[model samples]
Target: MMPLEPVVLSFGAVLLLGLGFGSGPCNIACLPYLGPVFVATGSGPRNAWRILLPFTAGRLTGYTLLGTGAGLLGLIVQEWIAAPWVRWLLGAATVVVALSLLWRRRHRGGGCVTDPASATPTRVAPPEIRMTNGVATGASPGATSGQAQALLPGGLFLMGAGMALNPCAPLTTVILAAATSGSASAGLLLGFGFGSGAVLVPTLVFALGVAHFGQQLTQHMNRWGSALEHASVGLLLLMGMGTALGWIAP
Candidate 1:
């Protein structure tokens, strides 16, 4: 049995490591993957969590799984992640995400608009709104329309998971510590702490900031929404291609 003190210290260290890196390096690393998706989704501050929660959960799951593997298989887990096939799979997945986004943008017509002549801004009511008993009511966008609503959370989850799988220095450090810990439970604990620390701050602050800013930007620049949307799609395509072709490091 390992000494409890060492394990506790190790866990704390790994968590602190995550916290230390999360504000700067983690944000930088994660933004490339998350920023475009968040912006293009056009979610407001009120609903941003709809996308963030699942994505954060996916990352936590990925970290836990990686840590467990490290503890169970020692260093062998590292080799598996480093394998070319893994990169290829992630790359393919990225390409698919890009394509899906492209399709959604094309199909989602009648975006927010404003009239220069009118005192009050008027735009197309979201498809999610309905008239019930002659009373205007809003419904869950995904309640009846299944796939479209599910796509954001589901894709974001995959993106989060894929991002976690990419070996960041903080994650690598945690994995190594967990591997040396020699207990799956210990690894899981360390992984959870680290994952929680890494995401708790940035996920809330950075994502919410982006969501708020993005919504404002979209509302103000409604006329250019389509162009911005196209640009986002283009960015996704480039990221997908780069990931697949090894132009971007995994």
Candidate 2:
């Protein structure tokens, strides 16, 4: 069996890049509006853990299934995947993600820069959540009030599942690289690692300080979010360049 550390390191870097600071579909930054719901319910910290755990679980479930399936396909044509040129291809891809972020910041003022990590997702929340008597609550078009609480888990899960929906080329590349290892389990392991990182940021945010520092946390995160984004991109560029230069080779 291949020593799995290098594979895991690659997946973690890519996953963090996607979730920690992005405007794309998989970025938890895209879901900042979620903080208010827990806050309004007066169970922000508790619910943050409960809902976010399952949200992360849903992501792992989807990624594992999809990655495992693709890995099986990859095994059928291992020669193609094993070609030395393939590593060069994957390395170039990592470089592209780094460059794309920089170019977007320079040219588009940080407009939506789609990458392989952006998943196709149905927006998790309703277009708008109606404040019911000062609390964030809502009902379906015809349903009675007080339904949001009953359905919050499902909503959170769906949102998390949405993260897995559109597999970007780069993400798919990562998965396929694992599949090329000739072990179907490699894809599953990588998926689990990636999904865990996806939830870690938002979970830590809501669980640690958001409950007590709702206004402050939001303000600070908003102010620091771009810096975090730029910082993560810089790290990504470094990670990619390191791989391209064989500095991170196993």
Candidate 3:
């Protein structure tokens, strides 16, 4: 078992780090994916709590699994590989991931566009929408019922997973390495803390607006969301490049 103190402290640090870094960019880039989840859950107090629970649960599961895997991998590397090589390899990998993100951004139109009326918007309609309507009759614009059903719980989970899977920095790997070398339980606990920290603020904001936030809510969210996505991509690219050049360690 992991020592309770270190595990708790590590978890707390990871959580705070995630919150500090994740709030602006992840929140913005992921709004479209999340908005429907909120909307589907009915945008009320009870629904917000219900969705938040499962969403947080899934996130916790993902992070714990990731941390555990990283911890195990670190153990293997520690046994077989030199520490310098590991750092270099991690740095190289970070750079590659960052470059990929940059290339994607360049090709995919530089993150999401904030303005709805702008040449491009951050969120686009899914390709499947092109197919002829089958399950439900096509309703007039601004209709809620059919749209709501389309944004089911399963769909929300998948989206959340996708959003979280984006290439992140060495934070998780570093934390896992520390914990696994010490204790597996500590690593898992730290993972939960990081996940919770990353999610707390947005979840709170979402909870607060469960009932109503008027038209401004959507508009403001869209604008900020786009900006956040752009920032995240840029940060990732810069960090990746720095790591690649040996200017920073993983």
Candidate 4:
């Protein structure tokens, strides 16, 4: 068993690292993916927690797994993350998610058009409306079905976990320390502690700040709602490809 004191110090160091990075670099890293969802969904303060909480949990899960692997496999975990195939796999997953969202939107006939009279965004489709030229025949433009709604939480969770898998400078340093520690328990402790600190800033910013801003933007810019949604989807697609092709640095 390794000395407890070293593990304690390492844990503290990693926790501080997460806190330091969480506000800036870490937040930036998460924004590319999360931003689209926040803005596209028009997540407000009331529902932001619903999205952010699961994501935070997912990130913690990924970090814990990485730390445990680091302890168990020493430097092998680092090698695995750095592998080219891993990058391709992560990128592919992102691309798939983007496609899935697009498909759901089109298939569900959920277009988000503004009611010019009320300046309000509605997701409900009229019964009198029918399919035309392969357009959405069911839900209003941009609205998802109950099935899609059910999967949203899970998707958000996976998104958080996936983001955490992209190792950053601080996280990599912590992984190195954990790998050398030779104690799985110590590594897990450090990973979880670091994750705890890492999520703080994102929670405040994404769940509260971004959410409020996104809702306001959606409301004020109701006329451009469809364009915004389309743009977000396109952004996700580009990012997914960039990540997969090594054009984007994690």
Candidate 5:
């Protein structure tokens, strides 16, 4: 019988990584752009089902592709590097990243770039704002809001793809390694299971009350969005530290 340890470990790693990163500060930073898609669908049972199906489908595709790619890479790494050393190196790097985040949080206010225009005391026009065609007028071109909604199925697909492209979770890396260490096919299948387990609940929830949740979050917590961002960062740092210290292990 095949030893189940590798597959089980990969599953746990992927699940933790997904949950940690998905709910962390980085996600909050991206929320302003992502929130509208959820909220635009309106919190109806039917609409919820509709939105979730496509989103999950997109996410599943993304995770599968990522796993495939990672599995291939893992095979290369296994040939080139010793496994224990690789794990330690990754563990160390993860800790360093976490430390950097904490350091930035601590010393964030030191560097300040003041506008020269402010010193010159020029009169500034009140920022003109308007609404037209059910969209905010005078909105900056770079602004993203409900923009994802505009793209609908395509946009959601891209979002899922992007999420997998550069997953920040340490566990994700570990899972990819574990999966690839064995059969690439096994790794890919495990990746699918991990992504499925992690994403299922949130996608379902978002589908159910996307619109209501969007409105409530935007209207009430917009100002506090930064707070959410910081909280997420803290969570990621904590998770990274826990893993590094072996308080939590794959």
Candidate 6:
């Protein structure tokens, strides 16, 4: 049995870690994917929150599920991680990802440019029509509802959930290790805390982006995106090097 106080404390610590992970360019992993979907929906600013709410909800749900899984499989995961070679392999994989990101940045010019034409949504103002007894007197054919479903709660939720499900070795190890230290309940709580922390920065950022769709948001995404991406990747690379050197157990 896990000690209650220590488990709770560990959970709290992991939660802070989650927040740090989610707070930076890693948040891009969560935001960029969902942002384009919302833009494609053509719902415009009016439905911004409608889109954001579900995505956040889905992300949180995904985190909870990940935690539960980790806790339940704690022993197995720990055992697998016990092998020295596995740790080395993970360290190598981390380095590979960091190198890949760096290469991509160098070759592709850092995917930070938001096309001006694309920034302005193609959604036209809804046509004004007089209605009487459920009859439209001046219905215009300008409105397109083809992408309406994509703007729905379900679509947004799926987008957010998918992002949460994006593979992350560090997060997985964190979850599994924390789970191994305590009961499944503790693991779940730890993951939950981590997820909550992770969502904070991205949530605020995407929320602002959605609420105010214009040049400012686009500029920030394009200009600062590369810097943030590099910073995040650099941190990961350092961690990988540290792990490879056996400076840390993980």
Q: Write the per-residue lDDT of candidate 4 for residues 28-79, one digit (tens) a residue.
A: 8888877887666666777787668877898888888888888887777877
lDDT of 1 by residue, 141-243 (tens): 2233334445656766776777677777778778777887888998898888888888877787655798777666655665666676667767877876787
TM-score of each: 0.81, 0.44, 0.47, 0.80, 0.45, 0.52
Model 5: which residue pairs collide? 25-232, 38-210, 39-210, 39-211, 48-207
* Residues 58-164, model 2: lDDT tens digits: 55676666556545655333343334443343334444444444443343222222321142222111111122222333222223223433354554554445445
Q: After superposition on all CA atoms, what RMSD does each candidate show versus the true structure?
A: 5.1, 14.9, 11.3, 5.8, 12.5, 12.1
Estimate, for each residue in 1-250, the C-alpha lDDT of model 3 and write its tens digit. 3232332255567878778755666566545334443331124444465455655555556566555554555444223333344334434433343343334233333223323435343232211121112225553322343343344333344334434434355344545454445556666666666667777776776666642442233334554544444454455445445543556542
Spell out the clash pairs found in candidate 3.
Answer: 28-225
Which of 1 and 3 is the better model by lDDT? 1
Model 3, runs deviating above 4 Å: 1-9, 39-42, 75-151, 173-182, 214-250
Q: Summing lDDT over every window of 10 consecutive residues in candidate 5, give the lowest-scoring window.
A: 123-132
6-53, model 6: which lDDT tens digit per residue? Answer: 233466677787778887745655433444433322234544565567
Candidate 1: worst-modelled 10 consecutive residues by lDDT? 127-136
lDDT, candidate 3, at 36: 41
Clashing residue pairs for model 4: 109-136, 110-140, 110-141, 110-142, 110-143, 111-140, 111-141, 111-142
Write down the lDDT of every candidate, Cα atoms only: 0.65, 0.45, 0.46, 0.70, 0.44, 0.51
Best by the TM-score measure: 1
Which candidate has the top score in lDDT? 4
